[model samples]
Target: MNIDTIAKMLFFATVRIENHGAKSASVGTGFIMTASLENGDQCPMLVTNKHVLAGAQQLVAHFIPRKPEANVPDLGQAVAVDLPPTMYVGHPDPTVDIAVMPLAPTLLLLANKLFIQALPLSLLATELPDLYTDAIEEITFVGYPNGHRDPMNFTPIARRGITATPLQLDFGGKPMFLVDGSVFGGSSGSPVFLFNQGTYRSGPNVITAGSRIALVGIIAQTMLRNAQLPVAEEVAATAHVKFAQELNIGIAFNAKAIKESIELMVSSAGQHLATAATGDGVTELSPA
Candidate 1:
């Protein structure tokens, strides 16, 4: 399909995470990992940058009701699912900025009340053959910038960008990649995907006609440059300043790190299997 069609699918997987701190509240983007169990079941878990929920006394996920024939999702009855900090499981590595929180038993019922679409763990960018990576030229990232969203349905903003550095090479000694895009505040934890449709050239004389899509990584942070000139604020006021300007470069943590982190949690005691009845008297399936 087109970008709009792909966006619709991606939007379902994206959620706005509202964090409540002691003195202030912040908003960021997060996507759900629909972990499938071998027993024909799925686990709904929230994944976001660890720093997004850092010092968060409370976490809530804002969801929009998605309809079949709407340009934007329906927001008439938006649902805010409450997430407890106690339920969160962080990556084993203290340095990795990824964390996950399972859906509470009570909130799990909302899955039926509204359309719940989550990103399947299978889409996690696994060990793709080098040939596929060689064919990839661009990727897309979806999220809210500066905490801005579609006023109608809270749809996350989608941005298209190209890889700024070598895929295999580590950026700043981390297993991450740099994206040349206008990523800003509130975009952290956004999912970066590589999608190719129509005709594509795999090699010098190799042409392909199928579509390809995969979740390659998630937004980590924006790169910056130390400005030679003082910022406007610094020039206006007489004070010592060391401010760096946005270099327009964005960082994406490799999906491998995320996969390892979540697996570590699930393999540990973080994975829970439970069932709860929905408002319609239907039971929902969850990871155990």
Candidate 2:
């Protein structure tokens, strides 16, 4: 599909999860990865940020449409499917902020056999022309923000931005842009895309040499603070009233960290495929 189309697809798979008694939370994005075993067992895996799924053994992901017409209904109205119990945790890598969860047989079936407009693996691997050259690149970021509830009813919004720099952040360090585009709390794990020619591929939107849309960073934090005035003089005088200032911020794991996690997961998966090919009854690998 085209770059614009791919951006929309990535947004649909992005979700928000509140953890730590709602005191802490994160926005995580997922993409489709289809795995084929030599023994003929083909499955689709959901790849996402590892910290997004951390702490919660059992989790739920909301799926929205890539494009929802103004006349359409909310995404929550869309059928909600429970993911199977198969969890594929990868050894957390300091360099990348990624992880993989193997789809349950049932979920895999739904993606491969039922979902109408799934993201294609081939499209993800498509190459762009001189993405890291002098060409100015435009990209779209998709994800559910704090206020967006349903996809069918509530229209998903796409934020437009350009690549200001290349992917040159220190591995395991914070990676991001100085885009005029605004993103909020729920947009943490949203995938950043770089438009190249007419197609889009996995990577940071690159604007210079050594820089490419390299799955480089995630929305980790947003700066926010609450202002409070001292209790009214009369009230303060009558009773001891205390006021405190608080700050709220957003932070995301660097995409390189995530990429490392995925590589580990893929390696483990490759082993499983090898075992399956050898007729070993679906042997699973330990988290790498």
Tell me the spans in candidate 2 whose CA falls farther than 4 Å from its real position.
Answer: 1-28, 35-43, 64-76, 84-86, 94-96, 104-106, 112-130, 133-137, 147-151, 163-165, 169-180, 196-217, 223-258, 270-288
RMSD of each: 7.4, 9.7
lDDT of model 1 at residue 146? 81
Q: Relative to the true structure, how large is the alpha-carbon lDDT of every model?
A: 0.71, 0.44
**Backbone clashes in each candidate structure, one number apiece?**
4, 27
TM-score of candidate 2 against the unseen true structure: 0.57
lDDT of 2 at 121: 28
lDDT of 2 by residue, 1-288 (tens): 222333334444444333332354444445555554545665466665556566654456655333243322234344444543247565464434455676645464444322222332222212222223232346556555653544444334556665444344342344433333565756655655543433343235522222223333454434455555556676667444444332332344444454445446656766433221221111111111
The global Cα lDDT (0 to 1) of model 2 is 0.44
